[model samples]
Target: MLRRSRCRWVFVCILLTVLLRLAPLKSDSDPTTQLIGDVDNTQSFGVNPISLILVQKLGYQSACNSCSHRDLGFTGRVAGKWYSVWADTLWAAPGVTDPELDTPGFHGMVRSSVSLLTDDPLRVVDLNLNDDWPVPHQQPFIPFNEDWGESSRTAFGGASLCEVDAGSATAAVFILVNAFEPDLVGAGVAKVQVINGTPTVTQRFGPKGYWWDATTTPHYGDKISYRDERSDYIYIWGGPPNRYTGWLEGGYIYLVRVKAADVFDLCKYEYWWGHQQGWKPEVLTTFTTETAALWGTGQGQIVWNDYYDCYILVHLGIAGVTLYMRTAKSLEGPWTPDLEIYSTTPIDGGLVYAGVAHPYLDPSGKSLVVSFTNNNRIEVVKVWFK
Candidate 1:
């Protein structure tokens, strides 16, 4: 009896331990909880750290000016290029497709990329939404290489797109990325690969892993970070891995810095010298849920309006985001918040997403020429603000 009792106690203890280990890790943040989900989840406007204007001039030309109204949204730095994600009216979503914001799956969730402008027609890789990385209108040199897939549940195919700043030579492409991959089922371990000749480098995470279906939180905006100060690294947030990934509806922001030294300066005769250069990225902090907004039932478009003067987050998910502004002078707390003037509801369209032109100043600076996706057409938002 005594031996049996001891054995039973040990068994119970072990079972309890396993249960505790498997217990779900809840996210403390609201937005983080919703945005950075298992499968998950832009640009621009205004200023740089140096305090110069972000958008200096604005221009528009419909790449599909002649096509049968195809959907395209892919922006690259090679000078005026974009590719939409949609194939046609059949590809429109409940939000953009059903514009009245009358879609049944009313949750404000954008699981893919939306291009603002395409230098040419829209191109799409024939891959699953949650399983492939698309190389916008352009074709990959290596036909065997798959674009890219959503690694962790937090990311929604790890959407990525490029944007040409309004006034600066500095261009960027926000991508759904993971610096590290966790060992779990369903969560895919990601590997970032740059095009063979795009003057860029790629990084690979740990062995491929899968996501845990149990985590269904919403994942939002990719985290763009600068590790070396030359260029920035972009990370797509999602759920998985007991450690690095946060289990909640949240936003993951990673910083990848690109420096002049890291680039291959053929003009100046600089090269990698046969060295492998990968994206060096790190996580900032995760935004909580209550603080962030959502797009469901009634509202949509929870976006961050970042500028050089400050990072203005518009919580359109709730009503409008609490504008938080930070400047190069200081990036700490107690920044200015635009308690007013940030519109909550869309006037003409439903949820609005900025396209390839991440809000730069126009030559006029009196207005903001922003390209956004509505239902069918890639429309531009002309902000007549100072």
Candidate 2:
């Protein structure tokens, strides 16, 4: 039954991608079709007009034909500039997928611009902006934690700035990284101290080199965070192996949170145990079959929108090819059903993932500048929710 169900989903996704590819690719207007049903009445997220504008690649075309790069995480402005951390980068000739070509990870900053939400094209310049910076390739943001028992492993496969301590003297930033070690593929947190505007690794917090919760079973945190004023806590999201696929990539996400001020301490971390059951002292991993998820999958981000007065979650859906959006009044419960927001086949001939929303780019929340990856190329879209 599981095999049959999976096959059916694969068929549906392929068919959807094929149909979407036929849509128009021109910018500054709606696509040939609005994949989310009619734009008139109920299906269009109510009567609001949604426009996807300036669908262009985020940076210059790679010098190599088939460079593969994906998974972008944004950092707080350090020394007057914003940074984007990427995972598994490669610069190679066309059709090159050799494992040896992997550069592991790297970071870059957006070129000097007054605003990221502008309609003009944007560029994600390499860290070469600073000549004295030790990292020429912007690699090795977090060294492999030997304490995690993965000493033989090299750099972290993925990294994201999950929390920023702006009030501190040196603006401490907490980064969540995926070890990606064969035997210990899980998540860990490291502290990055910004001194004189440059980010430097300080220390690592938590024992989650391979997070087991209390069960000690490995899980993957997409390393996405959102602060809730009602609880005054920043919720960190992780996903266990999918019930269907048995892969930790993205399915049935769970939450654990710590006070923004206490992110360095593991004792303060609390897990969600449903609305009625509330939160508990110990790390909560076990969940009843009846437990509900805020939304499905990872490889995305959650941003609070002031215009809609709700939190908008943009993620690469379970199908793996499509990008989806879901909205909720609060971070905890009662999220709307998956709404197909963008189709990659129409833009990049498919094979796209890591759909993230940049709320910092649009302070008004009326329009969102979203970034996603297609092989080595990173593309941004300006989505206006009218």
Candidate 1 local lDDT, 294-339, one digit each (tens): 1111111111233333333221221222111222222111223222
TM-score of 1: 0.38
Q: What does the lDDT come to for candidate 2?
A: 0.49
In TM-score terms, candidate 2 sits at: 0.66
Tens-digit lDDT track of model 2 for 235-348: 666554322233322245566677867766667777776565667777654433223244345566677788877777777765376677777765665566676666665334
Worst 10 residues of 2 by lDDT: 34-43
C-alpha root-mean-square deviation, each candidate = 14.7, 12.5
